[model samples]
Target: MRIAVPVFPGSNCDHDAYHALKHVVGVDTAFVWHKRSSLEGFDAVVIPGGFTYGDYLRCGAMAKLSPVMDAVRRFAEGGGPVIGICNGFQILLESGLLPGAMMVNESLRFVCEYVHLRAETGRTPFTGGIAPGTVLKIPVAHYQGNYFADDATLAALEERRQVVFRYCDPSGDPTAGSNPNGSARNIAGICNERGNVLGMMPHPERCSEEELGSADGRRLFDSMVAWLKEKGK
Candidate 1:
């Protein structure tokens, strides 16, 4: 599998994302700067977690207009697999690669720590290895992670199984109180209508090692690599 991880001015997690793919998954990974205009021959792309552009202009709003995002948009529209984590998720929303918008945390403060996420979709390449209701303990760190959409959109997402993860407690019980940033319906992740584009608030690469207390995040990346291999065969 070949993965392209984009790096913006303040994209602190790009290296970690690249490491996870290169070391944990043993795949060919490259760090692509935001100025680049095309994605070349990569099979998949990961917009890693971080405070891009210092989160200066509403989380990912500023980075959304970066030159590389045009290619990212093209990649997603072409049905290529694209995963956006945290700020990357925000960029997807801003770029219209995915639907909805992010808002300030209900508490209006930054949140950072390990949280629980329940898998809500299995049809996407990103979550194929995880069963429905599979509970993953992953780390989430962000300030503007709250997700919001209108009633019709939310209903459509639920009806289509486009929602991929919901915030929950360690016991696997969904709870708004457990929500790290007050995402609507406790949603921590979602996929585009076609299921090829995914955006989530949690950092999967951060939990790829057992030493991080959970290896659940690895399953997401592993599933993508395996899915690609299967497609090739």
Candidate 2:
């Protein structure tokens, strides 16, 4: 499968995502600049982590207006799979492609470390290969990674099974202490109502290889590719 990784000024993790998909996951991938208004020929798109637009006007707020994001919104509306990591998740929220908003870490500090994520559901393409309640070791790097939503929104997400992952202890328990950021309900990741678009704060590309201390993140990419192939056939 072919993947497009959109690159914006200050997008530091674009290359890492490209490398993970191209070399580590053995998929065709390309870097799509933020100014370009096309996402043609790509089966999936990844908005990688980084401080976009220098995190000005709030994280992802400025980047959401980029020309490429217009195309990305179109792609997602057409049911094309889209995954946003870290600041990218913030962009999705800003663009109205996903729910909720990001807040400063409750600790008021930049958090850069590996955390365990429990797969809440396997219904979405991004997490289909992962079994429910499975723990994944992934890294998160962001200052404004805390996720928040209204009670009604959270209830709807739970009802639709759109909450794909949650911050959890190594043993798979989602508790207050395990939440790296003060996200509502310990949510680490979530998908849209249609299940095609996903937004998560963790950096899956950083740990897609065993040499990097874990290969658990590969399952997410693999699941997306597998779903694409299945749909194509």
Candidate 3:
């Protein structure tokens, strides 16, 4: 399957994502400039992490208006799978493709380190290859990664099992102390109601290699590929 990795002016992780998907995951991937108006011919799209547009105004506020975003929205609405990492997650929120918003870390500092994430559900294409409650060692680098949503929205997410991942301790316990960014309910990642879009604070591409300290992130990409193949996409 062909994957499109969109590159905004300040998207630093676009190359990393391309390498991970193309070399590590062995998928056909290419970079799509921010000015591109169409996302046709791509089976999946990934919005990698970075300080888009210098994070002006807010983390993803400016990047949300990129010309390519319109196509991203249309692609997503058409049931194409979309995954956003770090700042990309913020953009997804800003574009209203996903619910909730991001806030500065509870510690009021930029957090960059490896954190444990537990698969909250295996029903979504993003996590279908992993077992529920499986803990993964992934790295997160972001200043505004704190996820926040209203009580009703959180309740709806929980009710529909849309919560894909949650920050947790090594033993898979999602305690307050394990929440590095103080996301609500220790949330680390979530999927849209249709399960076609995913937004997460962690950078999975950074951990998809064994030499990179861990290869647990590969499971997520593998799950996506498997799901797409199953659907003949």
Give Cα-based local distance difference scores for all models: 0.91, 0.92, 0.93
Model 2 TM-score on a 0 to 1 scale: 0.98
Q: Could you tell me every candidate's TM-score relative to the true structure? A: 0.97, 0.98, 0.98
**Of models 1 and 2, which has the larger lDDT?**
2
Rank the models by lDDT, top first: 3, 2, 1
Off by over 4 Å in 1: none
Query: Which 10-residue window in model 2 sums to the lowest lDDT?
Result: 224-233
Candidate 2: clashing pairs of residues? none
Could you give me the TM-score of model 3 versus the true structure? 0.98
| lDDT string, candidate 1, 1-106, tens digits | 5799999999988988998899988999999999999998888999988888888868898999999999998988888899999999999999888889999999
